[model samples]
Target: MKKILIFSASIGNGHNQTAKAMQESLGEQGYSSMIIDTLEYVSPTFHKILLESYMNLLRLSPKMWGKIYHNSERSRLIEINVLMLLANKLKKLINSVKPDAFIATHPFASCMLSVLKGRNNWSIPIYTIITDFTIHPSWINHHIDYYFIAHEQLKYLIDIYREDPEKFKAMGIPIMKKFREPLDKEKLRETFGLKNNQKCILLSGGGLGLGSMEKVLDGLNNIDLPLKTFVLTGKNQKLFRKVSKHTYRHEVVPLPFIDNVHEYLHVADLIVTKSGGLTTAEVLSKQVPMIVHNPLPGQEERNSHFLLNNGCAVHATVSEQLIYFIRELLYNPIKVDHMKQMAKRIAKPNAAEDIARFIMEDMASKAVSKVPLGGE
Candidate 1:
């Protein structure tokens, strides 16, 4: 079996989740793959400093992080320095892993691999899965072979490779196998202990739980609809404990970190979420309308923009807006259905499999081309 190495940094849940999804698909296609959290594994110090600092910025000064994110895109200094920091370590890791091909699910990893590929002239075939609706220039690197993007909408917008359309495959973001289809709603609801008669709302912030979950629930408390809100506080133990203990006007079910998030998503009538790219893709896969709440400045903000522009989701910057959007979607089944249809139009349920298949096919084609005229 061909060996594959996936580079995933645990900045947030998206990169690791995307990596696992791709790994699963690749494994099913008869490839051996291992995921490496290079930041944590290769350089634990950098992981805590950089990744923790990023989390703190998002939590404390999101607007500042936004400014830094956009401003840094205009300059390659940050990328260069980051590359320097990781290059030697990554080189050692690559030599150790000795994989046939490698994949990057995080921009940091992609950047490092791209620069190292050019610097060291090591061509083992590398690919990047841009796990967002919008493309940041940081993810761009000439040495990267193929770019798997969420859609064709921003293909031209990736300033560096506008001419190389062939390199950009709108294969969608790799979500897990379970998100391939929204399960039977009634049956799933019954299985999950949800009432059939009441409207259901699914609330989430990616795995880190960046959004103000308590405030969102407070806003929902004002709405008089017979609603059952299932709050998924992914990896947010504090939020889980708080929401689990708190009483609400509507039946509030606080969920711990779950592997089967897709199931609750399918059971939900309306979803209020902070738009991380992977979470957005998962919600879209479930064909549920979403209310994007105060997304953290950089990619999440852009992801929110894509969702709203695509007509599958509504945006909310404050509690009042959240309540309003929730009420609007609750009473408006026609609009909800329209949003679902729009989601269906864009969501690539088989994205993980498609990406894996694309990689293997490309590898096979290259192998065939390299064979001597009649000599294997």
Candidate 2:
């Protein structure tokens, strides 16, 4: 068994989800893997501040965050300084873990790992998984051995950024195995008390439930189609309570923090969601057409654009537009089917397993191994 260290950040659930997917995949492949929240491990105070500030920006002023994200992309000096600041901490962790390889699901972790590898000239293989459809300059590090991205377009984009195409692989973002497995759609609809004949539309606010669920649901209710609407409020208790009280012409099933999201996704004819990486990947895997709504300004906006450009999804920035799009998609089944077809074409259902196998094969082919699994 080989020991693999996976570093992820908690800015949102997407990065952590990608990290966990890889960890699970590696475990099944008989590898000893550890997942670390890099920010928390390096500095708890910094992690708290970074996480809270990000959430606050997303909740209050997303435009400001967007501006910051764009500006940061050009700040290579600043990025390097941040990396240098964390290099000592990362070095300490690497020395302690003594893992055979490193995998990063977050850009920050990738930068830190790149710095450590460059400074120490470590031979351990470093893989960076871009958990979004777009690539940011911050994610590009010359020291990284391989880059796993969502699509071929992203690979081309990264090539322009890094000037190295050989290091990139268009491995779709890793999702949980359950998402790839088939579920009985009719059984799921029955379990949720939805009508078998009606079309089921799922509205999700990602894991934090961090969007305007009430307004979106209200907009969807205005559509005249006979449909079953499922609202996943995530951890938003207030939104759940408000949705639970509301009655609509269509059946509205209000749920909070569900673990069986894949089942709901399986039964859904279309999904209205914010374009988080993991959620979008899961929806694509389920081959459900998407109406992207209120994507967070930076990566999510890019994710939405990718889906739209690829013909797999539609975008609705407000509730009214959401209603119109839903009406259009529902009334136009052919269009929905087309979107689903595009989704299926791009979906990487076996990404996690593929990544695990690639890492194993690459490690075995290397002349010098770093650390043995479960050994000193």
Candidate 3:
């Protein structure tokens, strides 16, 4: 079996989640894959607090978060130090696993691979999968063999930076296998103790629950719609408890880091979420229309653009607008149908399988090229 090493960081949950999905896909395709958190390999304590603080800042002060994100994108000087550390570690990792190829789902890993390619040559292939629709300069490097971008727009964006148009492939975004599977809407709704006719709006603030979850709930509670709301307060116990206390006539279900997002998506009429690439892709796979609420700046702003352009989702920057949009969407079934159809059209259900097939084919070609002419 071919061996693949998937690298991801815990800065955001999406990167690690994508790595897990890809690992599972490769396993089902008869490939041995290992998923490793790059930050844990470096400094667990620093990464933990840094990741937590990043999420908290995004929730409390998105403008500050945006500024920091933008600054990080431009700081090549600081990146050189990061690149050196990553290069040394990667040299050790590759020497140990001897993977046939390396797949990176995080920007830091991509940058490190670029730096390593210049310093030391690895005969094995290196692939970078952009989890977001937007492209950052850090995600580009001349040494990458293949790039799996979330959209065609990202391909163009990266080509502008890397100056190689042929290296990138717009494979759509990758999502968990469950999102690609079919779920019975009525059955799922009944299982969740929700009425068959009542529209369920699923609200998510990402894995760390970084958005204004309580404020959004309050706004939705004041709305004059007969809709049930499901809030996923991932890793945010305070927000979950506070939202659950609101005794609204319509049922409000508050959860903490649920494993069955596909089930919720199956029964949800609309999804109100921060426009993280992975969540957007999952929602697309489920054929659920979206209302992006308070997207973190930089890549998320670009992610919002992709959904808006595709007619798969709408944007609401404030709580009041979010509630109004929800009310309108729940009332106007035709518009909601249109959005859902657009989302379905864009969903690449076989993305993970497609990527695995490509990698395996490349591996086969390489192995065949190395055969001796007179070998038995």
Tens-place lDDT digits, model 2, residues 45-94: 98898889888888778899899988877785245776678656766667
What TM-score would every model get versus the actual structure? 0.92, 0.93, 0.91
lDDT of each: 0.82, 0.84, 0.78
Query: Of the pair 1 and 2, which is ahead by lDDT?
Result: 2
lDDT of 1 by residue, 11-106 (tens): 888999999999999999999999999678767987898888888888778899989978867875255766756756777666766777889998
Q: Tell me the lDDT of model 1 at 302.
A: 92
User: lDDT by residue for model 3 over 1-376, one digit each (tens)?
Assistant: 6888898998778898889889888998899999878767766775687688877887688898778778866765245776667456656666677677888998777777666655665566778888887877677776888888876656567556755777787787667788887778778778888875677888885433434565666667666667788888888788777777767667788888989998998888888888888888888888898998877887798899999999989999777788888888988989999998998887776778778888888778777222111111
> In order, what is each prediction's RMSD in angstroms?
3.9, 2.8, 4.0
Misplaced by over 4 Å in model 1 are 77-82, 159-163, 205-215, 368-376
Could you give the candidate ranking by lDDT, starting with the highest? 2, 1, 3
Best by lDDT: 2
* Model 2, C-alpha of 127: deviation from truth (Å): 0.5
Distance from true location, Cα of 190 in model 1, Å: 1.6
User: At residue 242, what lDDT does model 1 achieve?
Assistant: 81
Error of 1 at 255 (Å): 1.3
Sort by TM-score, best first. Answer: 2, 1, 3
The RMSD (Cα, Å) of candidate 3 is 4.0
lDDT of 2 at 193: 78
